[model samples]
Every structure is written in structure tokens, then in C-alpha cells.
Target: PAFTLESLDGVPVSLEGLRGRPVVLNFWASWCGPCREEAPMFRELSARQGSGDGLAVVGILFQETNEQSARDFIREYALAYPNLKDPRIDTGVEYGVSGIPETVFIDAEGVVQHMDRGGLTRERLNVGLEKIGVPAL
Candidate 1:
């Protein structure tokens, strides 16, 4: 029921594995225009902070057609971050997601620090990362 989604490369990724690291769990749908617009920014932030210091960004695709569709979206956006297909919307419901483009910031201790609904900008993400002690790029 917790965050457990396979990465594009077929790696098993779970929220538990991201413990002791600051995580940004973003819920998105390929059909959502706002999600499409903000996805690139999220990808950039994830790539910039992916390595050392345990800054993790995991994407959950909501209402996706299938794994291939999700994979295609990742490729289309050139998203380098790990993504999981949340077809049943289980993760979304657990996080109280009301709609697409909901971003939740989880701290190193796995506590939910901030929740943002709708599109996000690089500036907002930087502030959220700072709040979680992950440092901005």
C-alpha cells in the first residue's frame, strides 16, 4: 500500500528505501495539461539532486493506460527520475490526492512535510527542498 513502484529501467523502488533521504513524491497523469507542463521542471530538479545527500524524487503516474504508456511519457519528457505506474490510484488515495499534479514533500524521517496541489515551479520546489534540509541547487 505504501510507495512501491518500478522504475523505467525495471528497478524496484519503494518509499521505504528512500528513508533517511528527503523525497518528493509527485502524483501526475499524462492527460493532465498542468502535469505535462510542470513535469519537465520536476525532472530537472530530480536530476540535479539525485546523486549524493539522499535527495530522492519518485513520480507516481495516476490514471495511466499501462506501463508502456508511462514509459513513453518518461521518454517523451526526457525524465530521468524513477517513476511508478499507480494505475489503481492507491498511492494517490493514501496521500489524499484530489487531482493531478499534486506534489508531496517527505522529510528524511519519512514524515510528510509539505503538500502542494496543482502545477509547481522550480522556485517552489527549491523552497520545499530547503524546508526538508536537502539544500537547493
Candidate 2:
């Protein structure tokens, strides 16, 4: 299932727009402790994979009420990737997200490779990248 959502900057980001590249769709919330713990790893991976022909890191904010709080969280973490706000949480439901800090890896062909539940370390993320037909970071 394809979905479109607005980034924190109000720009539209669609899963369809990212079909040609491997994608890391991470579901998280501002208040989640695990989400905070894994944010640095996500930031590092996003930086490494953000350039040419690299993976796309897309963060989906879940169960968040304050948009400003989400914005602040992004700034505090110095996240350089796209973060989509899922206020109504329709996207989360579509993705079968049951908890915070869940991660879904999608390949270039838009096929899901893995669904990780809980905070992710760099090592785990690398494994998922490999599963999605991308080189380990």
C-alpha cells in the first residue's frame, strides 16, 4: 500500500516517489525512550546513506499531538533526513505499526525486506540494509 504524507517542512513525501531506492521507514514518537536511544544511529546512517544512489531514511512520527514538539525533536537530534508526521496514524496502521521505534526496510522495487520492532543499533540497521539489497553501512 502506498501513502503520501507531509514532512515537517510541509513538503509532500510519498512512498511511490522513493520507489527506485532502498528505504528505511522508521516509526517513532517524540516521547519514546527507545526512539531517543536509537536516534543517533538513525542520524548517522541517514547521513551516510543520504547522498548519491544511497538509501532513503524516512521517519514517521507516531501518536504525536504537537507538531512543534516533533520539530524540536528533529532539531535536537540534528536529523538531516525526511521526517513525516502521522498524526491520524493511518500510515502507521497501514504499516502494521504496533509500537514505537519500529522500522521497516523496503527494497528498490518497493518490496518489504524486514520489519524491526524496538530501538535499532547500527549493526541491526546494517543487517536490514543487506536484506534490502543495499550494502552495509
Candidate 3:
């Protein structure tokens, strides 16, 4: 799904902007416990790839009202990846997200390789990563 949402810093982020790299779309909310659970894993994955050059781990805020809470979540998780605001749940509906924490792995060609609802485990995460051309963790 294509979308253009503002970043925490109020910069626009679009799926089209990240064309050639694999993307992990994480749909989450600051109030969600499970979203918090998988945050560090996403953080580490993005960090290992190094600063927007490799795999793109993008967070799409879901059902969240307060921007400050989202900011706090990023700060607490030490997330280096871009997190987009979706106050109207536009991206969530586009991605068919029924739950707070939904993960979608899209390949370099913008094809969705895998999708999972709820929190992530290393095993399940590896399965998705493999589809996006990353080796098993």
C-alpha cells in the first residue's frame, strides 16, 4: 500500500521513497503492550542495517491520539528508524491491520512477502526476513 505520512519531526515519508530496499512495515500504537514488546527487536534490526541505507524498518502509528506518547515510545525504545503518524488510520486500513502490532515484510520490488499480526518472535521474524532477502537470525 502506498502512503505519505508525516514523521515525528514533521517530515513526509512515503513508501515510494523507499523503492529499492526491502521494507518492514510495523503497525503499532504507543499504548499497546505488544507493540512495546517487539520494539527492541525492530530497533536492533534497523540499527544493524545502519542509518537508512539497508533494510527499511518503518513504523506506522495506529489508533494513537497523542504525538507525545509516540515520541516517548521511540525515545524509550531507542528507535533509529522513521516512525510515521497515521492519526486517521489510513495506512492501517490499507494494510488490513486488525490488531495493534502487525508486521509486513515487503521485498525490494515492493511485493509483500509475509505478514503477521500480534507481536513478533525471533523465529517468526526470521521467516519474514528471509523472504525479504535477509539471512535467518
Candidate 4:
């Protein structure tokens, strides 16, 4: 199921809002070290494509951190993209997220195109973006 959540500033965001753009929905936990390591890559990707056509990166903070912690993480990383708080883990379960740092690539039509179940390197991210027709920066 497609999911929706609120950003730190209470903006409503949903998979539908991302339609017509390739989206990378990442499930992560604040306590996961691997998640921490891969976060910068996601941040960079989002920043690079934020103003580009047909590309978006939505970070889903899984059932791990409070709103304050999630906001703190975003600030610390200087992440410019929107981050969603999935406190109930419903979105994670819907996306079959079994662990931290899992990423799902959704195409322009909101179809799940690819799933990466572990840490994401720059190369992996580029490959996924390329697959989804999002030009790598």
C-alpha cells in the first residue's frame, strides 16, 4: 500500500504527491549504525535532484525515533529533502521493510520498481536512479 506521513514541519506528504517523479522511499532507524552510514548518500542524492525534473527522495523514519530525534537527524545531516515519521511502522511493513536502511525505488506511476535491502553506496544509488530514468548527478 502506498503510504503518507507528515514532515517535521507538519506538511502532508504522500506517494501520490510524488507521482510523475521517481521516488526513493527509504526505511531507517535512528539507532542503526548502517542506516547512519547510508544516510549521507541519500541526503546528497536528494539535494542533487531536489530541483531536477522527475526525481524525489523520501526518507521514512521507522518506528525508532521520536519527532525531535528525527528532526535532529535531518538537521545534523543538512538534509534538504522531506523526511516522514513512520512511528507505527505501518509504512515499513507495507513496503516489506524488514530492517534498517531498506530502500524502495518507485517509478513515476508509483509502482515499486526496485528494492535494496541494505546499505546504499553512491554506486548503488546511481544505478537505481538510472534504472528509474532519473539522471545521475
My TM-score estimates for the predictions, one after another, are: 0.87, 0.94, 0.94, 0.91
Model 3 poorest ten-residue lDDT run: 46-55
Please give the RMSD to the true structure for each candidate, in Å: 2.0, 1.2, 1.6, 1.5
Q: lDDT per residue, candidate 1, 10-72, as tens digits? A: 778998988888888888877778888888887777776746767888888877766676677
Q: Is candidate 2 or candidate 4 better by lDDT?
A: 2
Candidate 3's TM-score: 0.94
How many backbone clashes does every candidate have? 0, 0, 0, 0
Sorting all predicted structures by TM-score, with the top scorer first, yields 3, 2, 4, 1
lDDT of 3: 0.89
lDDT on C-alpha atoms for all candidate structures? 0.81, 0.90, 0.89, 0.81
Tens digit of per-residue lDDT, candidate 4, span 1-137: 67679876888898887789888888877677888898888877887674766688888888775677777777888888888878788889888888888988888988888888889888887777777888775
How many steric clashes does model 1 contain?
A: 0
Give per-residue CA lDDT, model 2, range 7-121, as digits (tens).
9899999999998999999999888899999999888888877566569999999998788888888999999999998879999999999988899999999999999999988
Tell me how far the alpha carbon of residue 95 in candidate 2 is from the true structure, in angstroms, after superposition: 0.8
* Collision pairs in model 2: none
